[model samples]
Target chain A: MAKPDLIIIGAGPAGMAAAATAANGGLKVHLLDDQPAAGGQVYRNITRNQDRLTHLGPEYTKGIPLADALDHPNITHVAGAAVWRIDDTPTVWYSLHGKSHAIHADHVLIATGAQERPVPFAGWTLPGVMPAGAAQILMKSSDLLPKDAVLAGSGPLLYLIAVQMIEAGQPPVAMVETQTPQMMMRAVRHLPRALLDRQQIFKGLAMLRKIRAARIPRYTAAHSFKAQIQDDLLDFEFTSKGETHHLKCALVLSHQGIIPATHLTRSAGIPHKWHKAQQCWHPDHDTEGRTARPGLWVAGDSAGILGADAARAQGVITANAIICAVRGLRPSIASHVNAHAINHRNRAQAIRAFLDAAYAVPPEINTPPDDTILCRCEEITAGTIRQAIHDGATELRHLKTATRIGMGPCQGRQCDLSLTHMLAAQTQRPIATVGMPRARSPVRPVSLGEIAALEQTD
Target chain B: MMTDSRFFRRENGTYDTVCLQIDGVQTHARATDTVAAALLAFGPAPTRTTGISQSPRTPFCMMGACFDCLVTIDGRPNQQACMITVQDGMCITHQAGFRPLEEPHDG
Candidate 1:
């Protein structure tokens, strides 16, 4: 491995951009990613699948140059490197090819990217039901697609995938949207601000036009939704405007929105604030991507849900900030270098305001039906969790101890947000005040043998 | 409950294919495939049942965030199928329940 002055954990847009920019600024950087390649989730397999994935659109196909930026001697990109832990000394503890290694770096930037927010519905854990993003991922990496796919829940990603599927010549059966017409009305006020970034708006509208051109059924304000396996397809039932609708499809892909993959950030004791707009725990970081903890920086969607373009800008901005700190370069110079990136980032974040308002997660998504499952690992249901809350498991910690909600292999990534919302809502308390799961050792599951074989590198 | 894979792979790629075994059945997967992807394209739905309720499950997040795709590969227990690449001759199987804890040996 190249001796790294800066370690960027995650080879997503932010990490890849930061690694290249920092290395160009005379710092040897080590970029580690869990995926087999450097293209993170947005452009997953962009390096390898660009030729055949034309249906994925130009933005995805255009990421190869950025992915290629790591082709410098100063940057060491390690694929299949699962980072399990980190510390204040800025040492990155990760497992690569079955061996654990703890390497020290002067500055550690976490750009681990975002994950699909888990909103449990009845029978969501069933075999044929999965996240909508999962379908996109399967298409991106494996060249696989589900012809009879039904997209439920609400967000930009659902539309993106629907358009992508249509282009792939395998249109989805239907889209049962959870966002109501009222939510659309409320979001209109922010449209002007969103339209400031005309390209982003046009991109969304173009996708909508394509989706309409394909003429797939789109149901809005869907509620009481549940998925069950019927014959060889997923039997999905939902209600909209008092009208019940049923769709039997080969697969049911669900999504609400995305949240920062904050397992590592929260584990590292970084201060996080509840982003009320996004309704998720967002790691607090400055514009330059510096956390309150010095030498520990966070950029990209992992910091918040600011799309790929902003993530790239934040990555460059953060790399410049790191350059200023590490090389004793002028901070003003770093700021100067990051000027354009900062402007682009501001616009992207502004555009997000309209999205956050429109697709604001339906309140019911967090509070699933009593029969719905809460923690997938434990198979604990909403009835059980609510009972635990009623049985004096009022606090987050108590509920976890009582029902084992957040104690799973995914480490609450699947259930933590819902758990927090459920507890606060059930108890009639404020959601923000009801804290979160405590920091745990492996954010990613690793074997006991692998831990015993860990070796430290200076 | 569905044993047939609901996923269909597009055959327009110029990529090489790799052969691996899923639950002792010989399966040919694209070299660009992950264990999870291969299972989706060729193997069964409800690839594995829940450790607690024995409820059938499949890989939820094709990203590594969800452990639904956890499978045993090359004698290792509880490996994330999405996190690893599909290799030729690699043995993969549906993981049921939690793996038994192996006792630590004296160093």
Candidate 2:
């Protein structure tokens, strides 16, 4: 494989920004993603027609800059390439449409992005149960909506999705939320930071106002008790303030938080730090997004879940840092005095605060209804998990070993964060003190046949 | 309109139901189906408990990576239902509290 001066692993906001900056700066750049197009999950392009909008309402995701970035001659974007592994030698091995290929790079920027955190419970594995992210995917990829859906869980995404649903004329049956007023109030410390991005603040505030106008019944501090498929509809059992209740709906959209996409990073043995504030795993890095290992740099959500704007800033800075490192040129001090530095720093700080305020999983979230199931794969129960804890597992890792919480095929992606929060609440320690379990491959539960096929060279 | 289950088929004999218990309630599941799937089929919205206040939980991502589906099985804690295969007579439990370590811990 021909080597590139810079290899950006992802085509999301961060990756595209980094790639554009690098390529425009005269470096040979290669951008790779597993998707068929350049936009990552959040800004996914559903059709060639830019006019097409999603059930998520207005087309907030303007892909013009990204499309323009793809037109650059110095940058080669490889789509539909699922990267399986990365070596410390800074080599990326991936499968493109079932063909084995590699990209050797002088410097690498891992803008691989973040994925939605799963909060597992009973009936979660049912045919109708899916993360709010999946719903977003369906909306972006196929313009589909879960018929008679109920959007639940916590975070900005919930309200965002609710607004989208209402705008799409497919408002969910109900919106069940776990975010307490206390949590929202506590998040006020981030207000100053939210001020920097007036547009985002206005847009987010507008969405919230719209949700209120839509009169979508939102239950803060309410937990989804049980989700089961009954009568071809999604049934949600909910509990709040020591009372248990049930609601029958067609689809349930739930989200806890998002974590850095660290499977590839961890597989390469990159050291990580568990960010308790964000409640997820992050690759350890310096001011520049370079990892502990040389040439194996990481940026954006692959490092932490700092939203799109933060991701973009991190990408640009990381790319510039990588360029300077590889080309043996010192970073221009004058650039630090320009709008670039101020804008980037402000954006990063604002997003960081927003993320810190936004990702908290409500404290009372673990109180499942007596009949609610906990582990969807093993069909476990809240009673069972509590019994194990009473038996003596204090930490998430130990709980994992004692009860197999994160060892499943999805590599604990589905229930680890929620488990960590449970541990933190029980132990009365800071959430940051909780340990994040390591991720393994294949990231998804692909069949052995798929693995065998992936191993075959073209 | 499009359901992923339309393509489902049994991998082994007996239709391969993966058996489990939800909140001590006995349940059966398929090998290919997640515990959440089994619970949903049996009639519930969630399969796991919450993080801070011990609320009921459910599957957000059928895939194992989401960490939202932690449950206990056969006395072990923190198992993700999205990843594990269902087996007959698998005693599953919900994870609600600070699950203690089964053995001595170094951290």
Candidate 3:
């Protein structure tokens, strides 16, 4: 296969935007993603020949504009391709359907987005517990609900999904959010920025308004303390405004916020920066998303959690920078796209900055009160990790190896960031300094029989 | 909505019979359901715990991707409760350390 001039690692908002902008800039672009669809987590598409329009709602359909870009002859969308390793010579190596493919490019854009932060608690292993993103995925892919659910955790996504459930005509019983007043106060610092685009702010506010209209109690300053399974229903205890309350529901949805997906970047030997406020490791980038390594750029949530609008602008900005690098000077169109791009970025940044402050990791996440367990896989507890740390397990890698923290299934996608945040905060080390574990091929574990069958094919 | 019925398996065991041990407590679990489903059939909603600060965590994503449902089953640690089937005389324990000793090592 002919090597494209540029390779984009993700097919999400940033990758799609980057591909479109790059192709429009006259560069040969190849876009790849592990999923069959291009839209990332936020705009996930239904795969079973059904209309994603009905399954995922309108915001997802907005991605249709970029999806149309796939029709461009210069852009080759390689769906189901998982980029496992970036060689020492910068050759991109990926595996798909048990086969390997390699691409050599002058430039690469890492747009692999973030994953959800796992907040482990007792009874998390019960049949009904699931990440808010998973619920959103199921809703998008299958048009199904968890059937009588209680949603908890901190972040706008939480309320958004709750409202989505209501709109889907399967409103959850209650929404238990852990957004503290202090966090809201921190968020006020960006009020001027948030106020810039009243439409964006109103969109978020509208969801809240709808939740209230549905009489679904929005419980702020609340935490899902503990849960017990009772007759196939989850019974939960939560504290709100210093009062403890109990409720019963069939499912629980939760997440703190998103972290940059560092697996590909880390595997490629790209350096990272730890944003304490975001409590996640982000790729170090210039204003245009150029990483420390030449010919490599990162944009969107892959760099950090700047919402979709910021992601689009950042993608464009990064493509412009790549064009400039290729031509050895700024393109004439740079002047044309610069002003609008800057405006979009500034507007997106305002809301993102507020969101960063508003959704800062709560105190509970760092130091889950002693009774909470940290590793549910091995029944590992917070006390145990602390004891191990006290026993001189200094680094995250050491702690992980010593305590089997990230070794569980799910490939540490869930607890890795939360663990990094806690360890970074405790040890006073930057989260960037902490090493992110690499994602191996067959990213999702397959059975031995499946592996044997693949070997036979080869 | 058509679910992949292949993912759902039916067992002939009685749903009401069988005593299981969840972290040293003699709990009742059904052989016909998944460990997670059986646990949910009981009183405690969360079957596992967090590694940092030992906060109580329940399975939020039951599809087996969240890693929140890790538990020590029989002698294995970090086993996903949602993906594993329930059986009689299963000894399930709570995971408690950053690296639980029972973790399956591919290293």
Compare candidates 2 and 3 on lDDT and give the better one: 3
- The regions of model 2 sitting more than 4 angstroms off are A46-49, A54-59, A240-244, A332-342, A348-355, A364-405, A419-434, A441-458, B1-107
Runs off by more than 4 Å, candidate 1: B1-4, B102-107
The local distance difference test score of each candidate is 0.87, 0.66, 0.69
Ranking by lDDT: 1, 3, 2
Tens-digit lDDT track of model 2 for A196-254? 77777777789889888888876667864577666656668887666776777666777
Worst 10 residues of 2 chain A by lDDT: A449-458
Task: Tell me each candidate's i-RMS in Å.
Answer: 2.3, 10.9, 9.9
What DockQ score does model 1 reach against the true complex?
0.66
Best by lDDT: 1
Model 1 C-alpha lDDT per residue in residues A1-458, reported as the tens digit of each score: 54589999999889998999999999989898998898899989888775567888888975798898899989888888989898878888998887888989989999999999997999888887889999999999888987688999999999999998999899999999999888888899999999879988898899999999999999988989898877767799999889998899888899899999999999888899899889999789988888888789999999999889889989999999999999898888889888888998888777898999899899878998899998999888989998988888878899888888878888888999999999889899888889777867687777678898888887
What are the runs in model 3 whose C-alpha is more than 4 Å off?
A: A46-57, A331-336, A376-379, A424-458, B1-107
How close is chain B to the truth by TM-score, in each candidate?
0.87, 0.66, 0.68
lDDT of 3 by residue, A26-97 (tens): 888888887667777666652331343452445666677767776688898898676766655456766565
Report the poorest 10 consecutive residues by lDDT, candidate 1 chain A. Answer: A439-448
**In candidate 3, how many Å is residue A352 off?**
1.4
Q: Write the per-residue lDDT of candidate 1 for residues B47-94, one digit (tens) a residue.
A: 677778888787889898889998888776677888888999999987
lDDT of 1: 0.87
